[model samples]
Target: MRVSVVICTCGRASILPDTLDTLTVQTQPAHEVIIVATQPSDIPDLTRYTAKMPLRVEFAEKGLPKQRNHALNILSDQCDIVFFIDDDYMPSADALEQLSRAFAALRYAAGMNGTLLADGIHSRGIDASDARSMLRNRPAVGPVPIAIKRNLVGLYGCNMAYRTDAISDTRFDEALPLYGWQEDVDFASRVNGEMVQVNTVSGVHCGTKLGRESSGEMLGYSQVANPIYLSGKGHIPPVFLLKLTMKNILANHLKQLCPEDWIDRAGRARGNRAALKDWIRGRVSPDRLTHVRPSPSGPKP
Candidate 1:
């Protein structure tokens, strides 16, 4: 199967090269690597890497969903399967090879997400060098195990793949906008076939803190609003939405007492409060997040 890799990134030009470096050693080289950025400055010079693999770069408006949709618009006609990985994710050498094997074996699966050997999104971010070391030390294993998850609501955005034909006409919803918190879930849930999880086709989500231009306010708002928006759209069940909302709100509130150095718990708590107020007033909408100005004290670009 012809495989394509798509990375929609913003900011973080400094670390993108390291992610691409990991791709150079992939056992199954991608047929093409398509990168969509908001501006030329969002990525590093790729002239040196072009000789190692087919690379294509394009510019788009900033939002993740919009940028990803732009990638879908320009995908090559020869592409069969497409992998959407984050700019900070580092996949193992055989990640693509295993993905190809899994897709070929699971003929009925429309999409799949590999297991994450290490994910820093939940804590202090991991450095690229540390992530590389972790990948190199992972125990050598045989063929990966694959399972079809009928009840999974979405694929992990950092390392997920989909059959091109299966999602050809399915465009990511642009409503979620920048940072698009749960855009992956919203998109994956709308696809036509079962989603699979491959155990051995793993990677590390460096979850580097840079290049995230969205403020804690924006993310916090989405934490509550996006799930509610998706639930109203019938893409996710109300029970799931309630659980997600409560979890984030509770975490933000509790963490505010002794916030993690890497997170802006207070700002997120304020955003969450605003979202709840809006909900009570019957004014909550995912698009409304775009209007919430970033806090001046929030993380820098």
Candidate 2:
């Protein structure tokens, strides 16, 4: 199967190279690598990356889901399998090889899940050599992909691959914009066939704040509102929505009361309050953030 990797990034210029570098060592090299760069300037000279397979970089209009949609439109006809991994996550050396194997094994699967972002040397920050050390010590997975339960929502947005044929004619919903809260669930739920978990296809999400926008107010609102919106559409279960909203609300409130530097608890609490107030007034909607102004730090709209 022709396999491709798509990475959408915004304001993460300094750390993007390291993410790209990790792809360079994939045991089963991708047929192509597509970059949907929200900030064209954030991307360094493409001429420097000769080791990666056929690389294509395009400047995107706006929003993470939109950027991903742009790439999927282009690659859907050209590739059999498409892998979506975040710009902040560094792939293991055998990541693509494992992904290929997983898909090849799951003959009827529409998509497969890759591992979530683990805190790998997050303090030292993301860099080329750090990725090398990360590969050396990355966890190992057995040969087979594990089947994800049917009732479970779906794949992780940070790392996952889809078989183009299995997805039928469905696409990522554009309603979930920018950071696209709960986008993974909305997108993958439309696809038919097996959704398996392949631990071998792993990556380290170097959670660095460098160049990225500080998401507080918008994120908090989305945390409460996005899931509810998806639930209304039958994309998310009310149970998940309930747990997600309550957990984030509690986290935000506790953080606000205690004042922690780790998370923007106070900002999010205020946002939640604002959203809840609007929700109480029957003004809550997924598109409520349509007019949110992108900060100077990241995600230009």
TM-score winner among the candidates? 1
- In model 2, residue pairs whose N, Cα or C atoms come closer than 3 Å (at least 3 residues apart or on different chains), thus clashing, are none
**What is candidate 2's lDDT per residue for 1-301, written digit by digit as tens?**
7789899888777777877877777788888999998777868766767655689988777788889888987875788889888887888888888877877776877788777546532243455566567668766678786554433467777787898887657878888767888888778877876676766677777766665446567777787778777888886568877898899888889867765454566667766776787789888876686544423342211
Query: What TM-score does structure 2 among the candidates reach?
Result: 0.89
Question: What's the true lDDT of residue 122 in model 1?
Answer: 76
TM-scores for every predicted model: 0.96, 0.89
Residue range 241-288, candidate 1, lDDT tens digits: 789899999999998898888888878887898889899999999989
| Backbone clashes in model 2 | 0
All models, RMSD in angstroms: 1.6, 3.3
**Which segments of candidate 2 are over 4 A away from where they belong?**
120-131, 148-151, 290-301
Q: How far is candidate 2 from the true structure (C-alpha RMSD, Å)?
A: 3.3
- lDDT of candidate 2 vs native? 0.74
What are the lDDT figures for the candidates, one per model? 0.87, 0.74
Lowest summed lDDT over 10 consecutive residues: which window, candidate 2? 292-301
